[model samples]
Each structure stands twice: as structure tokens, then as C-alpha cells.
Target chain A: MEKIPSSEITPESVYLSRRRFVGSLGALAASALLPSGLRAADRFEELRKELTPLKSITSYNNFYEFSTQKEAVAGLSQGFRTSPWTVKVSGHVRNPATLDIDDLRKKFPQEERIYRLRCVEGWSMVIPWMGFPLASLLKIVEPTEKAKFVRFETLLDTKQMPGQGASWYSWPYVEGLRLDEAMNDLAILATGLYGNPLPPQNGAPIRLVVPWKYGFKSIKSIVKIELVGSMPISLWMRAAPNEYGFYANVNPAVDHPRWSQSSERRIGEFFRRKTLPFNGYSEQVAHLYAGMDLRRNY
Target chain B: MVWLKRAGLPILAHAGALTPLALLIWNFFHDQLTANPIQYITFRTGKTALVLLVLALACTPLNVLFGLKQAVALRKPFGLYAFLYAALHFVTFVGLDYQFDPELLKEAIFKKRYALVGFAAFLALLPLAVTSTRGWMRRLGKNWKRLHRLVYLAALLAVVHFVWLVKSDVREPLAYGAGVIVLLALRLKSVRRASAKLREKLVGKQGECRQVAVHEDLR
Candidate 1:
């Protein structure tokens, strides 16, 4: 638990770091309204920019530990051990990297970009994600052509995450995406949000942020990354394939086995809003699904 | 007769059964439904309903095995409340999640095996609730007993419904199954005792029962 300096919290540091992030794309905010603690980015901002046009900037999340309540995640994740963490990158890449947490954060510059994260269960949260592009990390791994998809696995140890001990969700969190989807600029390997290290419940150290797909696809607290040629086995999909599809694209037209997908409740908003195609990042990821009927694929 | 008074105690038990429903509604109105209100409400209501249904089904064995005659009268209200929550669960799934999409609803029921089983359990409980009133029970007469047997079936369906819906874990359904088996065992024991008592009463004048003669020899 090393203490971050008070001066390191300023917006200029965050903005300067963000500006130098992967050739800049989105707008820089006034920075005055944002709290000092909410200004810096980690190493995944470049990838997050392409997933902009976020619906709301404060609500989407996957923390279920202290409470399933979205507001409780930040408070609950304080108990996490973020240091001495390592991400094991395995499978079809030429160089298998097992990088230390701090080393991973220092590898790339940071940026502050807002992106909408729509959950598979029909809820949305817009987050001012602070990190560099995931594609940059993928570049480092040097994925071979044989790799067709990238799968992510969360730490299943209930000792670390109390929520895993409960029967609430099929615990050890797992999610994945196709190779092209993984390499898509909209995809990010996030480590921080609002200028601070990602709260534990929100996937501290590092996690996948696949903006166009459902939130679950963005596996949190990732300890393993595998590149495979076949469709990766997803926990939820294997549990109930009809309810949670393998593709799991954010499509309004597709209805879940037991629920409708036409509309979604933005986490902070009072009312529900119509769900957008690719969660409103159609311009970026929609082409990836071209020639394929979303409803059928859904 | 003391037996008559004891039999009437079931009426008292019926009043007691309403306490849980009252507390549940009170908790909901008071905003004690947890942080994620939707999940909290859904889980609480569904769980309470399942508990009540199990209790209602337990009445027969409880009355015969434990002589909990008063518990028998609680069946109707408990059964109806189970239906109420089951209906509420369905509505929340449809209203809050689906927003009244008929095509989606139909497809969800037909396409997904678990959803279909859950929906069927809901449908089975509906008839028991509709005929729960004294007037309907009287009008239906003995047919009411036959129709109410659907509860046992409903209990089985409910357990299956939960089992199918669960992705991997079997713990919850296993608990429910154990409860159902214990209750059914009590019912079986009661039924066997009643038949034995009838045989003894009918043969009392003869005093020549074969088992009795064997017991006398052993003594």
C-alpha cells in the first residue's frame, strides 16, 4: 500500500500524459470540474478512445462483493492487494509475457477517455477510463496469425475476493472475444479509472475492457490471457448458451433467453434508454460483424 | 372433544402463516430490499414464496407425524402466497426486463428449456390459487382434493425449475429436494398408520390377529 503523492493528483499531469497517449483523438475536458483523484490514466487510454460516445460517465460496473449494488464496488474494493501482482500472458504469441504489475503500468503512457460499458443484462455505465490502448499490449505480445480469439480468466480464489465464496454468481469470473475483436482499437486492457488504480471490484491491476460487447466480455481481475484458434470456452455461455451467447455483441434487436434487449437502464440515470447497436459504437466495431445478421448471431 | 379443538387449531396456524408475507411487504416498502433494489426484490420475493410453498406442502406430514394439526389450515394461504410471488417473479421478469414483448416472451419460453420449466411451474400453481377460496372449494367438492394434488407436482416442478435455471451449482436445488423428501416421507408414514388403525378397529371383536398371536408367543 504505497501512498501516491498529493501533487501527482493534478489534471495537467493527467492531461499531458493523455495527450501523448497513442496519437490523441478525443476532446480534453475543462479538467476543473474533475477531482484531482479522477484525472490520471493508466496504460490503456489509446484503445479506450475509439469506444467513445459514451451514454453516461459514472455508472456501469461489475463489482458484486460488498454488495451487488453498483455504488458499493469502489468502497468494497479498498481491501484488495494490488501490489506484487503479475499478468500471465500465454498461448499463440511468440513471446509469452509474465509481467509484474508496476512494470506493466510503466510500459505505456496513460490517457483519460470516456467509454460506455453496456452490460449483457441490459444496464449501462459510462466510465472516464484511465489507461492506454490494449492493442499496444497486443503489439508487444506479437500475436501469431494462428490465434483466432483471446480468452481471459479471473482469479478464482475466494480468499482474495470474498464474493467468489458466495453462490451469487458462478464465481471465478471468465470472459473472452475473437482475435479481431481483441485487436480492435475499442478493446483496452484497463488498469486505472478516474486517475487512480482501478478499485479491486472493478478489476484492479489489469482487466479487459471490450466496449462494443457486454461488460462480462471485459473480464476483471485478469490473471490469464490465452490466444486460441477455436472459439474460447466462456463460463456463462457454457453455463447457459441460450441466455448468454458466445458472440455476446451488444445488439438491441437480440433478446436474451429470458429478457428483452431492446432497452437498457443507464446505471446513474433515473429511467431506461433504448439500447444502441454495438452500444452506440457502431461506427467502429459494427463492420466487424458485417455480412452477419446480428439477431441470428446474437 | 379435545380432538375437535386440536383439529380447529389449524385455523390459528393459518393466521400465523400470514406474518411472513406481511413482513416481506413491510421490508419492501421500508426500502430494506438491499442496494441493488431489483435483484434484492426479486431474490427476496422468490425465496419467500419458495419457502412458503415448501411449508404448505409439509402440512400433511406435520399433521400426521408430529400431530401438528394446526399447520394443515395454513396450506391455502401459503399456497396462494406462493402463487402470488411466483406471479410477481414472472411479472418483474417481463415488465422490468422485457417491457411486454410477446414475441420475446413466447420465444424465451419455448426456446429455453429452463425458462419453459419455470413457466410451467408458474402455470401449475395458478389453478391451486384460483380454487383456494371456501366457495370454490365447496363448489368443486371432492374434485378439489384431486386438483390440490397438483401442489405436490408443483413442488417437484418448482425444484426442477430452480435446478434447470442454475448454471452449474446444485446446492440450492439439493436443499429444496431434501425438504420435499422429508415432507413426503411424513405423509407416507401417516397414510400407513391410518390403514393399520382401520384394520385393528375392524378386527377388534375377533381378537385373533396373526401378528398379535405371534407377539404373545414371543412374550
Candidate 2:
């Protein structure tokens, strides 16, 4: 049970508040002034007193488009081109225009939201993501009456991302959210993390951040947003339909074949913590599935 | 050359098996084990155990298919190394990862099918590991060979455990499964006889090896 030093524990918030809190206060003063993120209702305050280091958050990743190996992703995705990127908002939308990455940033105000990302592989991380709500972005591109689902596609450059063309999964990784789920406040299109514009590994320019679902639903380096009439099958669903479903919402009771969702190992924590339903965002997002059966959905 | 075959080969085998473990320890001390160190260690050890198990299983097949008698000499050491790593894998799971929590351990063993099969594989290997010594081999006599047949079941279970573990992309595990299958297939009496006959008809026909490798009595 080796402990990370207390000094390194509260290191990210100051350096992370890059754009908004620029030169406002000293690092020490800012840490004191800054609100310790959404841990008020968190019962394990004593257990997880500090945030996961920005180094760990950046280094340990599940960017399969870069590599299957988690640690190798950061290094492999080094040369991935992000700038001059255009995210095409197409499919069943009123204003189906391909917006430039920079102009899109200007259009939407980015705010930092610290969310606990529970991976389907039983590992979890608390990431301070800088982005605007997906609802905000969705409002700009008004969905037509036929738009029942929102499908996202990651960048498909095999040249930039070495693992893109891998046969293990279909190319240009696709994830879908119901129209209501897409409009959820908790769901955001993340552009940056740890007070910095995303490095190539962490989805670079823009990626989805659906906090309540398994991390895979948060597709990275999104190149296309298709508002579809039918429920779009995600890449995981195509790969293993039985194991991975369309709605990959984090549920403790739903026991996966490989790893149990009942408990998860928070990256920094040594002991396994009991996983929460909807990843503890039940109050925020649970009402979306009021009458539906979660087990079948899972 | 005989001395090299007798001593040097065993030493090389021992070194080859132990080096990854040494490197893992070195990485742990150097802070190079990435973010989730426990997971890194678990993956490394489990992979090593699987590889060593595959290598151990391949030894007899190598002898049967090609009459490489020296492969037999390496089997016990490789099997023992695989057992050591399997034990370490379990210890890491129960102790470091789960923190010896009884409830968590029970749930992991019972609820997770992969864990159950992997644990069963470990249990199968335990008796073989305990009776691996010459004294125990002498005491067990003919039953030693019969008891050690559990290695095949252990290997199969390990493959099943691996196959079930992945969410998608059965490619990597399937590659390992193919390797295990080939090695296991080579062990079959009919497959061995056919392969030996094929080799004899090709290259071994001209040589002094007319007796088509009935060498591995365990086969």
C-alpha cells in the first residue's frame, strides 16, 4: 500500500485551468480557492482524498485506435494531426455543415468538468475534461424529426493512428447515443484535458465524454456526427453483440463475462471500490431509462 | 558438446524463464510499470505463465514429431516455472489486487467464469508442482504419469480462460490457442505416428533413424 506524496496529489487544477484562469492567481492560491471537484457526495472522501495525477490520466489510456496496449497509446499517437481538423455534422440535421475545429471552439465555450470514467475493463479514472456540453453542440445542428439516434465516428487515418486499420475492430470506430442521451448534460464533446488542448492520444481536437456509460462510448478524435433515423450499431456491438450492447451504461448489477462491473479499481486506489449504478450519476441521468429494463439493455 | 547439452542448456532454459521476472521487478523499482502497476504486473506474469505452459507442453511434441530428445530434459523445469508464475498471478490477484478481502475473493472466484477456470487450472498444476521432485516421482511411481496428465487439461482450461477473457478481438488469444492446439495435436498418438512416418519418408528415411521415434514413452 505505497502512497503517492500529498504534494503531487493536488497538482492538476492550477495548471489545468489554462485558458479561463490564466494568471488570475498563483498555483498555491488557486488550489486553495478552487473547489475540490464533485466529491461532496462522494462517501470515500478518506479513501480517495486526491485526484489521479495528470501524468497517469494522460499516460494510462484505452485508445484502441492508437494501440490495444493501454500504456503504448500515448507514445504511438504522438504524431497524430489535430489542427486543421473538420468535424462533419451530417445525417438527419437541418444545418449539415462541416465546421472547422478552431471556429467550432470559438462557437462553444469550454468548461472544465471532473467526471469519474469507469472503463468496461474494471479500471476507473477521474478526469478533469475541458469541453462544452454535447447538448450545446447538438443545439447548433438542429436534429430533424426523423433523427432518433446520434452516431459518432472517430478519425480513420491509418497513417496518423497505426492501429486504425486493425482487423480486431472495424475502422473509424463508431458509437451511438439516443437523441435524449445525446442531449444529456453529463454528455460532452471533450476538446482538452488537464488544462491543455488534448494531446493526440486523448482524442486531440474533440471527442465525446459520456460519463455514465463505459468509456468506449466516449469515442475519441470524432470526425463525423451522424444524426440517424435508427439505432446505429456501435463498433463493439458489431464485434461482440452478446457481450457489448448498444447502451453500455455503467451498471453494478450487470456482471460482464470478462470483468465484473460490480466493483472497479480506481487507477490510483489499491483496493477495489464498489461500482455504482449509472456510475454514481443515477440522479443526474437515470430518469432517461425510467420504464426500460437495464439488464436487457446492457 | 555433451556437457553443453547436459548443463548449459538447462542453465539457458532457467535464465530464459527467470529474466522476464527480473525485468518486471526492475521496472517496478524504476517506476516504469505505467499507471496501473498491479494490472501491468498481473498481465506480465499471466502472459509469462501462459507462454511457459505452452513451451512445456511443446517439449514432448518436439520429441515425438522430430525425435528431439533434449526437449524432454527441459519439460520439468519449464512446467515448474509456469507453476511459479501461476502461483504469483494468483497471489497478486488475491493479495495485492483484492487485498485479501474474503467477500471480493469469493465473488471473483464464483461469479467470474474466467477466474474460476484459471483457478481450476492453477489447482490442477498444484499437485504436479508438489510432486515434481525425484523423491516424490519415485514415491508416486506409475501414478505420477497419470497425475501429470492433468497438464493437458490445465493447458486446455488455460486456453478457454484466455478465450473467454477478451471482450472482442479474439485474434491475439486465438493465436495463442492455435499455438496450444498445434502443440496438443502433436501429442496425440495418431498425429505423432503420422508425423513421424511423414518425416521418416522424407529426410529421416536416409538416416540411421529407421526406428520411427517411439522415444517418448509418455506419448
Q: Name the candidate that leads on DockQ.
A: 2
Top candidate (lDDT): 2
CA lDDT, every model vs. true structure: 0.69, 0.84
In angstroms, how far off is A40's CA in candidate 1? Answer: 19
Which lDDT tens digits does candidate 1 get at residues A120-174?
7666766767677777887899899898888888877677566666674665666
Give DockQ: model 2: 0.60
Point out the worst 10-residue segment of candidate 1 chain B by lDDT. B210-219
**Over the stretch A131-178, how does candidate 2's per-residue lDDT look in tens digits?**
888988788899999999999999888888888777778887999999
Relative to the unseen true structure, what is the C-alpha lDDT of residue B125 in candidate 1, on a scale of 0 to 100?
90
Among these predictions, the greatest TM-score belongs to 2
Interface RMSD of 2: 1.6
